[model samples]
Target: MATFDARQMQSLTGLQATARTFLMVGFTVVETVALGLWLALVQGAPVISRPAAIGLGVLTVGLVVEHVLTDATVNGLSFSFPLARIVGISVSEALLWAVWLGIADRLGGVDGILVAGAVLSVLLVPQHSVEDNILRGEAPLSNVVNLNTIGFSLVEGIGATVWLLLVFEGQQFAGLLATLGFGGVDPAAVGLAALGIFLLVEHDIGVTLARQG
Candidate 1:
């Protein structure tokens, strides 16, 4: 058998790593474009669907941002948001507290209580405020739509992952184990999603600009 030196092994591993990066990035961009083309083709005739398309586009953007930027970038964003996020934090925090209290009994006593708390902690608070801050358009609900779509997409993705995991061999796959094993991340998808979102937003903005022109 031909033997690889340490440098050769490193070179081979680097090649594989570079290949995965290219593939992942390509996948994200392709998926984003595919979805946009799909939506445009299917709903091109309907005026009502334009908003939906934009909302979907924004969701894609959030996915890209979160995916590419990672937890680190988002957390770092906190420092710059003091002025913009104050109302979101205050109002959302209060609303979160209210919902937590109102649903306490419905949430059941011990186990259910924790579940209800989890909903508030995990799902309820951050997004509405986030949308509220970004909603600067004449279309008042655009931000809300963007926020909810993002939340929904993420939920869908994670749910899909879990459902797959529940099946027999998902967790056993060599690739899956290798990726998860190394704590490797999918920054390509993140970049792709971000690029898609930007394209979508630009499209929307372009349409409006052309109309004005």
Candidate 2:
């Protein structure tokens, strides 16, 4: 019987590491493009609405600023094509948001979006479980799964979802912005801006916790 060694898994090197890195890159590119095409060409969806487009733009710019301020980079292989990696990641993030929003819009407008948000939130737990462990140099399945990690991710996701809906749908929030002299802006765009701030804060918190652990 062959015993599994966690250290060996973490120490992937040379060809194995390179191959895995390229595989991940290919997967990201394929997934991003496929989702965009499916939403636009196959489903005949608008790809993204004006409000969503504006919101996503804000979110992307916000992320870039956050990265700059925090001196953080997207985690992945970028040894050779750093610029391409950054551009690809930015494009991928935007496309993912558009795809999810497009699907939710078709499902039932606001209700659909909420449903989709919930699903995505749940899906992220396992993903974070694996990614976080790997990034921390532990076996992907180490720790028997951390409840704290799950809790943080869930809160982040739910908070983001609620924040998004409130921005786009909450008249009170818009009214407040209006009172602040920015009433002319589209509510969705405003909501997205707030969403970006929320994400920045959430990311910082997550990073802090990860480091502490």
TM-score per prediction, in order, is: 0.25, 0.49
| lDDT, residue 172, candidate 1 | 37
lDDT of 1 by residue, 48-159 (tens): 4665446444435434432232212222223343332334333443344334433544544444444544565454324432433332222323344333334433442333
Local distance difference test, candidate 2: 0.50
Predicted structure 2: clash tally: 0
Error of 2 at 196 (Å): 1.7
RMSD of each: 19.4, 12.5
How does residue 10 of candidate 2 score in lDDT?
A: 58
Residues 91-174, candidate 2: write the lDDT tens digits.
545555555565566685567768867766665565445445544546656753566566655664665465556544566567
- In order, candidate lDDTs are 0.39, 0.50
Strongest candidate by TM-score: 2
Model 1, residue pairs in steric clash: none
Task: Kindly report which residue stretches of model 2 are placed more than 4 angstroms away from their true locations once superposed.
Answer: 1-99, 141-145, 162-182
Provide the clashing-pair count of each candidate structure: 0, 0
Off by over 4 Å in 1: 1-4, 44-213
For residue 106, give model 1's deviation from the true position in Å.
Answer: 28
